[model samples]
Target chain A: MKLPKKVKINEVVLRDGLQLEAKILTLDEKKKIFDQLVKAAVQTIEFGSFVHPKLVPQMANSGELVELISENPNDVKLIALIPNLKGAKNAREKGVKNLNFVFSASDTHNEQNVQKSTKDSLSELKEILSYCKEQDICLSVSIATTFGCPFEGEVKKERIYWILEQLTSLDLETITLADTTGMANPQQVYDLITELTNKFPHQLFNLHFHNTRGMGLANMMAAMQAGVTSFDASLGGLGGCPFAPGATGNICTEDVVHMLHSMGIETDLSLDELLIASKTLQQLVGHETPSYVLKAGPYDRKYSIPTKK
Target chain B: MKLPKKVKINEVVLRDGLQLEAKILTLDEKKKIFDQLVKAAVQTIEFGSFVHPKLVPQMANSGELVELISENPNDVKLIALIPNLKGAKNAREKGVKNLNFVFSASDTHNEQNVQKSTKDSLSELKEILSYCKEQDICLSVSIATTFGCPFEGEVKKERIYWILEQLTSLDLETITLADTTGMANPQQVYDLITELTNKFPHQLFNLHFHNTRGMGLANMMAAMQAGVTSFDASLGGLGGCPFAPGATGNICTEDVVHMLHSMGIETDLSLDELLIASKTLQQLVGHETPSYVLKAGPYDRKYSIPTKK
Candidate 1:
């Protein structure tokens, strides 16, 4: 059970977490959550996504939210999710310095998510890369459905390798292998990550998992065992894939931090402040979020002894 | 990770799962769930507890349920939980062949749960052992709060070792280290189990975990890595500690089997049948259970590709 001494969490509650919710959070609401995240010492955050207003109404205010938060003098890296070159340009114009380009590894899922084949998405990534370079913006890539796909099912390691080979040659800050629908098992995560890290030792990889099947933390443990230190998690475990049927929230940020801190792995994030942010997110969502730490508190929490009757 | 080729599951839904529900199930309904568990090819089941009827109204029918189900000619081992010699005698009167004596490793939790200190419980175990021997009933023991205690906090490994030292001398079928409040983390589980297995090489040990903190599956993975082959899981993730505040369900049976089967580990249980049993439990309880596989199917389930517009 050898694990890393420290790990990095990239909070994505604002973008991926709120994208599927019916209630559209105003810029003020998003800013409130942003301030809480900053108070929690979140090093990097996916603030929002640059998508069409009609396509994803909840994230239509991504540009405005990013613009409002970018003015703060802080070192917290603010990223916006982009599906194509237009999304990247939109985020850049709004002063989002960091952009994450996402596309599914499976052709069927890729087509369903972004209306383009994996090959076409790769071609578009080239243009997005050149555009980001011209705009002096940092870029990353998220290969969704790297483990399995709802439509196609059982995505192969070769497909992930193929996608990574194309993206690795580009000037990207990181490459995230996402279990988009929470279809990944621990063994598969360990094997794929072990191979990927060994083949490309210098490439920085991030893992994004969902707790849809109750394997989120286990998969993260496997990824850590395979030497991955960066992860994408949503506060209060708020998020779901619209295309993936019965999809649940992403691996929760508070729960992940709880596990890591329990196991003596440092994340540099304040658990108490994270719980405050999680409570705020739950209030904003108007529903119970799938956050275990919020409900159960930390493992070290002590209760008073019951007096004998 | 090195995992066993085959793992054994001791289903505890009948006893622990139902004990917490406000809606007490009828004898016929309990039989239905038992039949479904048998249909799923479950080898071991904790049928019910022999506590006082008034203490646990939900399990008051334990005597009747055991009498009715034990008559069926099957190889499935039905075990009853007992907190003291009185409960053991009561279970034996109903013709239960297997009995599991439960006490907590933490003195405060033991006192809260059973109105006795840990030392008193160990002393009572001697009488229960003799009674079981006289009745020719096979017996095991479950040590609650082996990881941590809500009241005392951080139940030390020295305490666990001391408890096991007393129990290992007795003729018990197996011993279970239970995270009664879901406070056990993976590193602690791995380190403790590894050390225990090394020290007590001949003792058969089982792990009981709760998903209260979302570390159930991860802790199970860590235990498996430490060479444990048997576990206690509840169907639909049912069960919680009545005394442990904010306790959630146990590690879900269907979810555990789903993960093991996905990792190429065998449990000799039909996942589809388990899902059916889980669905029955959910309906019988008239609420949603915290089952991941029940809500999101197995990982191998494929969805049809949507036609392009």
Candidate 2:
């Protein structure tokens, strides 16, 4: 199957990559990385999540970060994740333009994660959606654990379709299906993406994959084959859910970009610039990052010939 | 596209796994692992390589290992790797019933690896083929770097076709195209496998992939989409050429089997038994393996709900 010429890459390294990290990056450090991403021509960046600080202290600076970089010097879309109406109010007060609201397709996961049932979370999302419309703020909703649930296991596709039905009623422009614990397979990815795109022809669909089972790239390729043109990736594969066991990180941004560009698909992000951004992250983390392209250079980097001893 | 009902997998960890390892497993250790594979219902296992001990000290006991396991107690195909006419003679004397010969599609890699030009190695292979025919032994040849070379950047499809033209003259039953340096992408794998399988309808084509750039499982899925069934995998993701820089281990056997089985595709090998074999290898190597299945278990493995503190 032929893929689209250009795919939109929404980088989530700061929000998703740092949420589960032990060493919470300082505000200055976060801003420096944001500047680098803007310089690298990254169109969209998920800066931070507006969750309770007691729950996720790493993202405690979400409001201030949005306040600092909300100017959008390069026309970059800075997205702040809001968990509920309270988080949405906090972001709007801080002048955050674009906001992402997240809920899980699994009722059990939604209850465990947000202390509310899936129905209650949808009600809360509707409140946030109405508030965003009144404030003239751009909004998108993401369904976590869309593929599988760590507690329930093998999440049914009907759950996802029902959620999509609810979001479509709100006339939302975009929706993202996230493999929160990385429990997705290629066949499921292709089948679901095809079904969703066919069912909602007007809404933009994005895919968020974690590399928990080493099927990240394979799943991405399958999605591309199903005509998906938007993806979420982490700069250094930095993020994981604190509650999920053995959830390593998100799909490395540079690695997938390298593969896509090699296949003659455009990601609109420079591998060289991404590597530099990844290297800067290594210094903050005081070790090497978990990126394949960062570890091994681009595909065309030739190997040197060995001299005879 | 629908995949085949079952795919044939050849386990190559015993030979390719230990060849580049710093740890040398004894004969009894090898036998114990072989017994576990047999218990796992593995139909084929590459026991060892009959190469010069001076070059690869780890494979010095190949002939002895073959002599010990050549009885076919479980009806498994015990294959050995032979580099030249001398190694083939060594394997034949040891009562090995099945053998695989190695060469490279890239001329520079062929020269660096076996100290012979491509034409010269083909000539040498002709000699080995004659000997195998006279001895009534089964044979398969692997053309390494069929995708890309560490020394030479990209290998042309024309080069592979030419090699096939030469091998078809001998009426070989099977030929394996190996991505030696893990430099292959999904598009290249899909296009090449589709073309070759269509051109050579009579011969069985096997694909060998390395997880160097984390594209192993992706490439395998693409090959399956192209209608190829046979594959070569390593246990616990062990082995890489000492001469090929930046080349990592082969695709993990348990991981691939887990993915295939989850998709309703049968591989005829038990995942639980493969994990036991992976554990045995870890004990010998004194570290955790690089396998995702060994770490995360299978997809059906359920997680419990979190308790309130």
The candidate that wins on DockQ is 1
- In order, the TM-score of chain B in each prediction is 0.97, 0.96
The DockQ assigned to candidate 1 is 0.68
In model 2, the clashing pairs are A17-A239
Where does candidate 1 clash, by residue pair? none
DockQ scores for all the models shown?
A: 0.68, 0.54
Cα-based lDDT for every prediction = 0.91, 0.85
Off by over 4 Å in 2: A241-246, B241-247
lDDT of 2 at A209: 94
**Model 2: per-residue Cα lDDT over B1-309, one tens digit each:** 446778999999898877888778889888888888887788999899988898888889988888787775688898998889999999999998788999999889988878888888899998899899999989899999999988889999999999998997685657999988788898999999888877777767899998877788999989898888999999898876454443458998988898888778999899999999888888887766668777676767777887988
The CAPRI class of candidate 1 is medium
TM-score of each: 0.98, 0.96
RMSD of each predicted structure: 1.4, 1.8
The native-contact fractions of the candidates, in order shown, are 0.72, 0.45
Candidate 1 lDDT by residue in tens digits, A190-229: 9999899887878989999998899999999999988999
